[model samples]
Target: MNRPRLAVGATLACAGLLAVGCSSPSQQAAPAEQAATVNVALSDAGCSPTPATVPSGPVTFAVTNSGSAAVTEAELQAAGKILGEKENITQGLNGTFALRLEPGTYSVYCPGGQKDTWTFTVTGTGPAAPTAAPDTNVADATTKYHDYVVSEVNLLQPATKTFTDAVRAGDMAKAEAAFGAAREHYESIEPVAESFGDLDPDIDARADDVDDPAKWTGFHRIEKALWQDRSLAGMAPIADKLDADIATLKANVATATYQPAQLANGASDLLTEVSTSKVTGEEDRYSHTDLWDFAANIAGARTAFELLMPALQAKDADLAQQTEARFVDVTQQLARFKQGDGYVDYSTVGDADRRTLANSVNALAEPLSQVAGKVV
Candidate 1:
């Protein structure tokens, strides 16, 4: 019998190989029969066993990237929804993922600009085996959250570059305008930003974070230079540091792992930032761009909530619906303050409007806090 090479530390070997052909008699009787397995080879052309139709039941895909590309990922998708996937499958190496798929049509995606897709079918099954156990749900949510972080971080790099370029060029007017846009991208994924030690502070530290006035740096430090001093003469190095910090964050987010509870708490923490600092007009004190950061923080927190929404809905639909409704309410209230792509200056808002915005955010935060308990 032929045996496909197994990935490192693979728990289960390729299924359906006859014990008589490949294993000794003693080895054959040692372990119970395992689920069926399929060997999938990914290369420049695409996935082999193209249209890998298989039976519906417990199945393991033994995937190998035989292509020249440095990295690739294999995903099992059905109806445009990902059922299972493994990322960072390096060339010439193998990786495996198991799934108990229901009878249906599925596609294998080997994404690397190859545009490779292998459509297959899962036949014969009473019902698709439910893979939505607590642990699985948490794992799926974590993967999605990491993906979101990567996307936001990718966007941050260019946006920060634009802001920093303007600052370094001594274009204070353009730099001030670019500030809110760059900050928004960072604010949206601030939770993941906390992972890289000192990077977040290096990019966003406020004046009080440093004891020495000369030591203060990052966005707030630059903010003072633009608004208070009304100049960008000494901001070139600061802008360069901010750009470097964002580059560091982008690298770190690619491998970061998140726990479901942390995601739940992260959403709440973003709101806490809004209520304590953003709402009070403290975060963008000089630029008066607090509203931009406030909205960005909402976008980020909402992303965390949306990522876990599937698990939450499965665990408790009523609570999920309630939480979703609250989010919509807050969004609508925030929209009232929108002016073009940004919001009205923080100082322009009257006390009544501030109180109303505070109440809306608080209301959403209350139900949002229960997400971890419901999902986990």
Candidate 2:
């Protein structure tokens, strides 16, 4: 998040006024102690606190997970010191952490920079304890869904891996057959996607409309857009539209904002990689058929999110909003990673690249699921 610039006042009149006040002593009042509770969650960018407010003195933070993501822990930190933390927190929906705290400013943080953070200020005296919301029953919900997605991914993995391996081996026939089978498997889950939207849109989109057939194009929409015979001639136009959509989507999704120069720097580098890097295909990768470019893109995004996480933990919404812009950029490019470096055809890429892409996509499922789960 952006840090506020401190200004020094050195006017003679101002100095004289300060001196007068200092010279005149008055009764001092002791700072009052208060109590409060803060709710926190993990995100792709940083930790997030619901309500963003805490009472003074001996405050208890109750961190809760209301979605289908695995969050191992939530921690409270300040001044580079770890104040308190709850580990082995529940995953999926309804997991929580309760922390007792003294009145002060605290940062709520989660590992992996995958959650938003908040800085809560506790002032004078605790209020009467408020009743807690009943658990959302997220643990049970997460178990059921996690098992389902795992099963689906397992069923599709073999065929997809085969297609990717065939591509790497330059076996066109095998690649074609494997690609078709993988597509069918992914399509089969469309009806179940709606249930996973809270975890990952790609999966949710799949499960929501498998019956549509027209909608069950699998990953080909992006693949064809980037690698089809005519796609290159129109790369600029398509990339332009894609970039525009990314900006719009980021704007739609922004929920916080904070100090941005550093964030902007990271975002600039990320965008450059997308627009000029080999994986985005501005550079030739045929001579170097490795999928490192795709991997780098994912790493860059994860880095940007990490850089912005601290600010998010401070509850700097403005910072979160700005960082999210970059987040969207990275994720959008990631979604298209399959197309870069000739991996779109599924048969043209190696098994390793395919697996890497799948893992990257899967990591996003939980956070996206949580975002979608929020009514807002």
Candidate 3:
């Protein structure tokens, strides 16, 4: 029987998101006193009121769960801007979209292609803020990094499939060969494992050998299992369990329970890392680990912005205010990464190849945090 490789990257993306997304702002109103409220529903049918609009500057969205099945999450968008989204919708029968928004065009969207179809607008003198420029250089580098990681992650999928096919076909040797191919991919990325540490600790935590390898224990163990020369003695039973677990995980991926508020409450690990990524002096060169943290923080801030857009549109002062405050907090946390000297060295430093890890860390976090705080 073939042993399955783990979809560790999926968890990596999620783990990073959870680390950062769990820190949404406390409930607060927008600066404008009377924020409007819009109540909506999500279902296999569609979002009602094909086209919708609301006055801007602090709006509140009260979403009611009238559908037969439960709605796990909600989002608001307009002009490529994510206005608001709530992942904490456990009210089996009753739920509310409590959020604040700013003046702008908006739409209430849902995950898994459950778009609201209707378009909405929030009109008013919204909060004044400056524009944010995507750090193209940083983005390009990060994109390359993400692609490399994704490729390695994707490579395991085929190997896993091969293992499954072999097991189902009763071909242990073929399963072992597929496992070998997968292991090659893992070895290719081992030198850079430190870079993936924050994004994928599960795979990183595994031992370096085949026999006595950690069994397919979710992301890390399964991933490590894929790379080993199939321990036929050990791999057979593990393959049986993996085949079952994959089905369960895929089934739950879509309608899975999401707790944004709960997630928001547990962001200290990533947030603390963001806050502490400060640069110290001329030694400002950064490692892949710093960049990984940088990407996670940026993604988190972006998620928060999208989560709050709807509330801003509804003129939900408290919701908008709270989101803004969270943004502020996240940004402030990021700011600690910036240098007190107002300059960054994108290149390496010193004849001895010493790096000013502190300063570069601060530099990466500061601008991103500023962008997150200001990008409405």
Candidate 4:
């Protein structure tokens, strides 16, 4: 479900610029701390790296895209788990993402490129020495953020029920409307759900995210049935599966725990989601409700950042202020497309407007990426 950059090129319909409840990995390294940095290039052809092995602990992938229109993002993955990623890299832009990696080979994936994937190796040296014990601010941030994740799942079940009910009843209008609404809840807390492993994919994976067509079951599968196929027949079973999956998600998150950096990374990941998949309109391709998702992802990012505000501000007041300003910049741009509760249809969005939104997201993402480093 993580390698979505390649198949996503469509622009989003609306730009809600809403708040955050958002994904995870654990590591603690301040920006001033030294770590192994790997430079990865994403181009029209594919992903490339300097190819140096480093002892594993803390590693940052410095990503740069040159002369590539299709390649919008890059991800670092091993064992089907997304370790880290940097997204929304329009041509001529550079981005970076960090993680505490164990020694192993990882894939550098950039879709819609000539090559699309590359191998990078990390030597096992274990994680860096632990940082000082976290202060109360960190504890509060994690505790509140975990509750936020649980809240989203709570909303997701009932909202999903509304959509599933509509589908079962064959009411296309209500189903479509409910579909986007339910997704907003899901997208906002995607990072938390993602932490639960297969549940994320089972509940939200797109057609492209899976290898077997039979394995494709989630909001997207139901989406295709309603929009592309234009019928609700045989949807009841799929709806049932969705109910089960989301129920399972709720149960899993009830006991979930989080680290400080994981919250920061989850916030950043949601923005990456918007920049890469939601912006492309590829996520809700059949319905063209990309804006709804765009807004929800932002909502999640904001929620996480705000939850960590105390710790972040205490550590680096300037960084906190800068991140807040960036969020405002993105939200201001998105405000132009507002249409009552939602925004205009994605198809109606002009090319210039698309560029404006993309630029704003890129700007917001820039400062947001540094958050984990600051707080941790």
Candidate 5:
């Protein structure tokens, strides 16, 4: 039920929109470009407003879930990565996210429809060269965020090894114990993982995400064998691949570029990640260690928000204060579920508690959503 549903290798030319074309994002729209708005309707059948052509430059996709239980998200993809997207749009919700797109073709993915994908060609030349350089603070935010991602990767690479080594050694208790320890690092920097083409899925994709079950690999795959199957015999290959993939992510993240606004949007994405799947306890169905991921996702968003604080505060102090307050609200609420250094099993969370957690996420998401616009 939960996976990186947006990670079908579906991408965004400019995504992470909640403005209701229900887009999701790995990055934000270009700052100087004037945004062109487009509305796409999502239904059980498919995306309704499939535009054949869109003019070049920035676009805001307002994706509305016109009544689709299964179809809850949408994405815009280009060049093998998601630029932006808005996801978890259930039956009636609508939201927007923006992107600065260069001329070319982009894919619109509304997973769960009969015909789940659409293509739109971006016409005309792209944005004119910027007259001024970006704000210095914004530039610093990007650089710092990049470094944060690298540091998280440094932690993840070794932690994954500890987990994988336990898996291969047939030590079920050790493997299970190391699972949540390793995943929190990846969870904290998921948007960085998503920015790479198939890296996110290769490392984190669940069984539901793949067309063929045999193809499923990565953390969850090993997780299922450890918790559900109660064996480690076949996991050596999966463990090796998982470690190799994290190594690849560690290598790629050092060179990746970022926009300051993406930090805000990435925070939004992290919050959305919590609200969408993790909140439902579907993220770690087998292990029941979802709260670990829940914490990590929020922590990642919090990191981005902190990194963007300088720029965000410079632009809108009131918004910054409100955003910070909301972060506290959510953090306090989340702390209720914590036990020791980790959180309680997701299975123990009652419906009322889940609602409280989801509510906190929504409260923070509202303000976090606005951060990019003001700061960028």
Candidate 6:
């Protein structure tokens, strides 16, 4: 069942504009003030220089990945949202990013399975700058993302009907084929699906989420019956439940609220899902249709990024261009694995190709994380 866990902690850290220390050549010279710099080292154990305290002003983070073979990402977060991040910090590389901070508590997330938490405090007496006025750009992006969710959910309705009908007819071969088609539409709108109370778990819950085996219902449960058990005797009810839940999602998404930051966070979360479970074939263990889900997740995330592009470009053109380029690269890489209108089975995808796909996803996730900061 491709139940996606939002990778909210992992954030983007990258090169951005340096703070101006002096006036331009055509203007009078001003006093030079060096921005504060923090050195952060990430390893398998934990981040070094833990619990750092800094002044409230422009600060630069010099991050080094001293971890093992597993790639790591570093991020600065506040109020459950990423403020800044640097991603794809390979075993031995270093990266840097600059951000202006206000007085507050923040955490540095080093996502590579490291459990140790690193937090910091920003303190200063300097008068805070006036907050920027709310812009319509973010509102527009949110509306677009909401519309996308509704469209995907609507697509799911007809697809689910076909899938359920195949199951009811006891045509196992046709049902199995219809399963992937129906799942693609669901996966594309998973974030929105999850917003509906209990609907997501009802339609896509894995066995782990259920306390009792008999209580488990929805796609994976039906999948087990169709593939592992090789029986359709008890699957019609599960199909009906899935159909109802999807209908519920269709109605909920019509009034769902979206934030500009969610688009960026959701994009990163999708890639994290691909790297964590989808690439490993753990998501669709029974049917081996992980590729379909993986592609749909990527499509969903890419759509969010595309909708936020205008606002992101206005704030940071360089970052926006970098993100778009990486998205194209990843999309092209995935296209290589396509077979006709669908993709090859996850079981048949080679290890090298999987690694390539993972790398491309990580590359895209890096810049995508910055979109929130730029747009919001």
Q: Among these predicted structures, which one has the highest lDDT?
A: 5
Write candidate 4's Cα lDDT for 74-156 as tens digits: 77654444445666778899877665555556667776778877777776544555454436777688779878988898898
Cα-based TM-score, every candidate:
0.64, 0.24, 0.30, 0.75, 0.85, 0.67
lDDT of 1: 0.68
Candidate lDDT scores, in order, read 0.68, 0.36, 0.37, 0.74, 0.77, 0.68
Better of 2 and 4 by TM-score: 4
Which one wins by TM-score: 4 or 6?
4
Backbone clashes, each candidate: 0, 43, 52, 12, 32, 4
Task: Judge candidate 6 against the unseen true structure and give its global Cα lDDT, from 0 to 1.
Answer: 0.68
Clashing pairs in 6: 12-85, 12-86, 13-85, 13-86
Q: Pairing residues by index, what is the TM-score of model 6?
A: 0.67
Tens digit per residue, CA lDDT, model 5, 79-188: 55666677778888987776555566667777788877778667765444454555666667777887898899999999999999998889999999899989999999
Error of 1 at 372 (Å): 1.4
Candidate of highest TM-score = 5
**Ten consecutive residues with minimal summed lDDT in candidate 5?**
17-26
Q: What is candidate 2's CA lDDT for residue 208?
A: 28
Q: Candidate 5, residue 168: CA error in Å?
A: 0.5
Alpha-carbon RMSD to native, per candidate: 17.6, 20.3, 17.0, 7.6, 4.8, 8.9
User: In candidate 3, what are the lDDT values of residues 1-376, reduced to their tens digit?
Assistant: 0111122221111222211111112312223345456766666554552326665434445555554353444555433322234433434543333333445444555533244345566555644232333223222322343344346545645655676667556565665444434333433333123122122233323333123444323233433333343334444555555545434322322222222221121121233333333122211121112333343434443443344344333434454455455555545544544454221232333323223343433344333222222211
Candidate that beats the other on TM-score, 2 or 3, i.e. the better one? 3
Runs in model 6 deviating more than 4 A are 1-134
Give the candidates in order of TM-score, highest first.
5, 4, 6, 1, 3, 2
In TM-score terms, candidate 3 sits at 0.30
